[model samples]
Target: MTPPVYTTGQVVVNSGSPISFTATDASGGNRTAVFTGLTLNAGPNTIRVRGSSNSSNTTPFFQNYITVARASSTSVVSGTTTTPPTQTTISSPYTNSAVLAGGFAEGSLSDLLAMAPFVPSTNQFGSWAYGNSAKTVTNDTITIGWHKGLGGSLTILKDGSGPNLINNNASITTTYQGQTRRENGRQSDWAGYGTPFGYNQNGGGDPYTAYSPILNAQQRDSGIGYNWVAGGSISQDTSRILHYETRTINWDGGLRQVTYFKTQPMQWELRGVVDSTYRHVFYWLKGREVKVMFIIQTFRTDGQQKFRGRLQEGPFMYITAPHYRYFVYTGTNPTGETGTTGLTQINLSSPCEGAGTAGCPNQNDTGNWTSTGNWIGALDESNNGVFIVTPYNSNFVGKQFQSRSGDENSNASAYITAGPHLQNIDLPGTNFLASASYYVGSLTSFRTWYNSAGIVKMPFSFSFTPGKTNGWWSENVSGKLNSDNRYEINIGGNGGQGRFYSPEGSWMANTIDTIYVRGRFYGASSMTMNLQWKRPGETEIQIAQFNNKTFTVQGDGVERTYAVRMNGVTNWSGMIAFVKLTNPYPYGSFTGNEKFIPTYIGKTNPN
Candidate 1:
């Protein structure tokens, strides 16, 4: 018989030779077609076959294999064949290096410096060495030197002594009591000193009694003040650097390097006075114009104890920049103090009463200072200064300036009373922590650098616990941190929302292009969840919204991950002041028991 013709689309072709075919019985009453009188090639070959319902309509073709034996043999092999699988390539907008450049991990320092705006000339980004090692941690702005003799204290150096210049300004020198004084060098002992008794020596309190983690006789007699440091307390074990690392962290906007160092657990004083362990973590991040230090203190007790006392000072930092003679306060000016609203300047040139005396010039600059809106800054004649930012949380209550001048030690220095004033309180095996940040740079670049630094270092966490919202708030919706570490929300009606609003503009909207949400939904009806945001200074009253349908499951309760892209949204620009999640379904159409549990919310630049 004539060979069957094959057709594709509108084209048809006939075989060159006549062929024979037969039908055979198969499983399930199916029939198989067999063909014969076909020539074969020696190696691999591709065969194309087509089937048609009729002459007018053609069905898609599939592959079949038939291997013929040599003419001397009498057998043939027949089976269905499949093309080998093709390798697929996945493409992403971001690279692995870019994504992990500033994140917290081993070997993240080199990646951070590769993308940093300013890099240090001497990069000592590694594990810290102890003992007589001369290893130092230097960045673009400052050098944290490891004292060779003591092998514990970290001396802060700037200007001439430091590695880089602050605002391109060189260190200045001046005369003080016929002694040479430089603008920048090692200024103070890196320690915290306090006492259970009152700070006043004449008010029936111990004169040479104070508690410090790194108290020593050498630092006490340095002439800043002999009375503030206790001689009996010198032999106490000083806090040693237990661990150090250069790691990256994902802050608000992007990744940045956080040089972290944890101190060994040490008692507050010589004897087991409080019977507690005090540990500290020092975080240093170098900015383009300023060097920032975050001091974190964690307290733990072996048992219940009472720390009823009058004065508790410490985490004190003394700066002896000779040119920084004027003390400036940026906050609500104290009633009888100096300067305008939100700004005050105090001259440290002349000595106050008891200037050279022990704890003479220690005064509360801001009466009952509570808000983060205040900061204590010391400015020089050229507007270059170093300022200590107020703590963001409720650990500190007031700001005090401890200065010394008009004595044999002509250079001025100050300390912040970081601890709260204790009268009588019981800490029952309680674990608590507190933190504060410091800046060293020129006054002209303060605001821009300060705001950027705050945004980059702002804390955002969703792994919540009971009664802790993690800076999140709700409106018309009740929510709680579940046992599984998920944030569960129950919506009662339409327009119910869960929000995180920052009036001070904590998020840089322009830097973030996508918001990643991972969660599970439980509901029968279809509903639309929206991601909304607002810009504080924008004229539009309505919040910007993006519909996200990832959580709209049919009561299956399956977890899903999705992204809400903000790059195309016109209003998602500038500083974002608010962000929230809401649904617009009516009450009767959707069940009020439609529960949603969100595990994480992250912002990034996916594109």
Candidate 2:
């Protein structure tokens, strides 16, 4: 039996040592005592061993014991014990602290979104191939569309009419809207709007022979005009006009495309077909993150291997990174208000505007909006909400891209710029990838989730909910980073109770009641439990009463509500209730010493 070299528990003696023991090993070998002196705690006669350790640091070798009075003799024996009224363990479905309940909520929502930096502007150019000549024309009218999940089907008409098809049906006129046709030297011809290449608008049994033309895919916003430029030739053989149409079907509660067609007719045929109409709009989901990806081949037609275009010339997805409901907390601009330039690391900031603030800054500087980095963030001035973002793919080098409000970049829209773009492609047939992720929540919660997930460096708080281990234990215990990213916790621990004070013996006080804790806890466990009122040079008090109950979480990853009220105790360290778990294995494993994580402690219930 190896002797225990270390001990964990609160101890204070008026005269003699509180703990006196012999150190030994399994092989009958004696080990030197390196144990430090302990400062005895006052008032509490009940003493429970929190943890114990051997020199070898073997698992399952530690145990918890209690100092119970023995009526038979003056000496007392160490044994298992239970001390407490009742402790109810609440199970939460929220796997990450960064996840929010309803994301964000408005006071009275008419056309309200619970979260902000709402869905991005349409990506009308996502699924289609890029080409020099536009090929998506409906009856000579240019059209583009994408399937929206649960929202509705979206089809835009480029002939200047807004989206013609929405919610799987036509909301606007389907008739062909007229658009100007630019000619080089040849006379223009006008033909009635026709259906797509193989469709017969007159309900005829015979349809035109099906054919497709090879179109050069061009970047959508790569400084190119949405019109056909004259090549200075009037000859029919020298001019080529492309047409496009979409065929769709009802799929999985959403619209799915059966096929998209692009066709060009010989100019000399003069069969009388109108120039293609134009539409530009993309798909977006409400209160959800946006992701866009497409494969781009660098080689041009006629077998040009290397891309001869400018390094900055490429079709990139345009999006807004809104800070409408959030404010920059950490990693902000030189002014410390909102992030005006692209950054590699940023915190969502604070002020998660539940509904919204009157005048919030939600734009970025146009000049450095497309800055390159791995992370970015925005703030919600309305309620101190934060919006953190990260690029999930390597090919996507742009992470902090955003749009400026009231600037020429966003056309004066209050949209923040965000999304993947093909900025520097000089290689041939190189596959460019774009991907990103986002988290919206309060500043403290965002930090906890971000640090625990090991995504990026930013302000972070520790989370102690039970469930699968998230690997944040090291940083949480070490206190490497802080909530404001301004200071750090340099004090080390015995790997047991959480240290709230700095190494200089300064305590950080938390006043929020109805706190939520998630971590492994056993019987007879005691720690400072205070909701408010922490005075200088005062020992924190423990909960006097505990309540046990069961609850069902509404949605996975959504915050729930819980109330902690003192049942039958007087001034028990300002504690309301004690929640404990019998089997802590479900949430995570513990070595009998690590402190519990107070996942969240607040006065307001997020639910």
Name the candidate that leads on TM-score: 1
How would you encode candidate 1's per-residue C-alpha lDDT over 238-303 as one tens digit per residue? 233434455455632446555444343222232212112223233445553233332222232221
Clashes of each: 2, 56
Which regions in candidate 2 have their CA more than 4 angstroms from the true location?
Answer: 1-294, 297-299, 302-364, 369-373, 378-380, 383-388, 392-411, 418-428, 439-448, 454-607
lDDT string, candidate 2, 266-350, tens digits: 2112111112221111222212222112111122111211111111111122222233322222222212223233123233232
Alpha-carbon RMSD to native, per candidate = 31.0, 33.9
TM-scores of the candidates are: 0.38, 0.23
lDDT (C-alpha) at residue 16 in model 1: 23
